[model samples]
Target: MLDGILAARPRGFSLAARYVAFALLASTLNLLVQMAVMGLYHGPWALLLAMAAGTAAGLAPKFLLDKYWIFYDRAPGRLRGLRQFILYGLLSVVTTLLFWAFEITFHWLGDGGPLRYVGAALGLGLGYWAKYHLDRHMVFGRA
Candidate 1:
């Protein structure tokens, strides 16, 4: 059963896993920067700004990784890399809006430092899902 389940899973999931890891690392770095330099903590505006920055930060590495490693297609005139970037940028905005919405909702929920971080995590995860699927198929696929 376990082997069957594993076999049934899409290979894109593995690629997505790597993409998520890299994005998380970038996001974490961005978050730390916002916290240390900007001194933002547990506020809706602060979280939104931090996440926006983090999303932008994540895009660079994510693009490189997805192009060279994850999708790994080598066609001289494909132009998918550049197209992927633009699509990903648009999707990133959607993700950012979703994250901001969640952050605002969480802020309305209550005041707890740890919970705020959890809210951030939730938002990041949501964005990651969209990015992974879109990158795997739309951005990288030949079809």
Candidate 2:
């Protein structure tokens, strides 16, 4: 586990850079969805609904980009693809908890003007960092 996280391969840096870029793109889309939903809806569950919408918006692109570019996976088969997606979601549940925790904490401590987003970004960044190692070792069958 430690070595997986620490190993410095030749392509590791490049992959890391690309992964982060894609993660930012995904995050932006997620936040945009939340913002749009919040803009139109104002009910007791607005925040919850916005977050759910944002997460759904981000998942597909993130999964595709990660499976193809970040992980370099191009296996051909609908069943295999579905399996990978399921495994991805299973792993993501943990990271998503981290993200939600951070966002909710920030919301609680903030004045409701982007503090939660800052938290979400930070949380997602950390989650992605951990997730990279997990995917390398597990999802892509690296080692």
Candidate 3:
């Protein structure tokens, strides 16, 4: 059964799907951790603290999955990997800001919990779109 499942999986789809799936799994785990931290602290600083923690945790899986599965770039030296990591860090900042913007905007527009999720989803989707293109072309060298 496992062999059949593996054999039936389309190569490109599996690559793309797994990368995205791992990213989302990592992000969810990161966010849950962050939420726990936020609840523990219960203040404005909690949000920032959660974000930092979430970003740190989220980046590692994202980098590994993208490098090995999605882009399949040749292994570069430590410095190059670090440089790429820094770029991803910057991207994460942009994504976080966008997430907050969407959340706040949606809240102001009378959105509650579920709608907040919708806003977050929209922002996250946009962030991933940009990240995929940037990783494909710039980081991995021309898709």
- lDDT minimum window of 10 residues, candidate 3: 1-10
Tens digits of per-residue lDDT, candidate 1, 52-137, equal 66656667766665566566655456465577678867866777777667665776676735465566678777877776677667
Candidate number that wins on lDDT, 2 or 3: 2
Q: In candidate 2, what are the lDDT values of residues 1-143, reduced to their tens digit?
A: 63343232335468768888988998899889999998999989888888888887888788877777777676789999898888888888888888888888898789766898998888888888887888777777762
**Predicted candidate 3 versus true structure: per-residue lDDT over 1-143, tens digit per residue:** 64354334336576657767866876686667666776688776665676567667777777766766667655659898888878777767776687667655664565434464466566666677777777776677754
Q: Number of clashing residue pairs in every model?
A: 0, 0, 0
- For candidate 2, report its TM-score: 0.85
Best candidate, TM-score: 2
Query: Candidate 2: minimum summed lDDT over ten consecutive residues — where?
Result: 2-11
**Ranked by TM-score, top first:** 2, 3, 1
The runs of at least 3 residues in candidate 3 whose Cα sits more than 4 Å from the true structure, single-residue gaps closed, are: 1-13, 107-115
Better of 1 and 2 by TM-score: 2
Residue 126 alpha-carbon offset, candidate 2, angstroms:
1.1
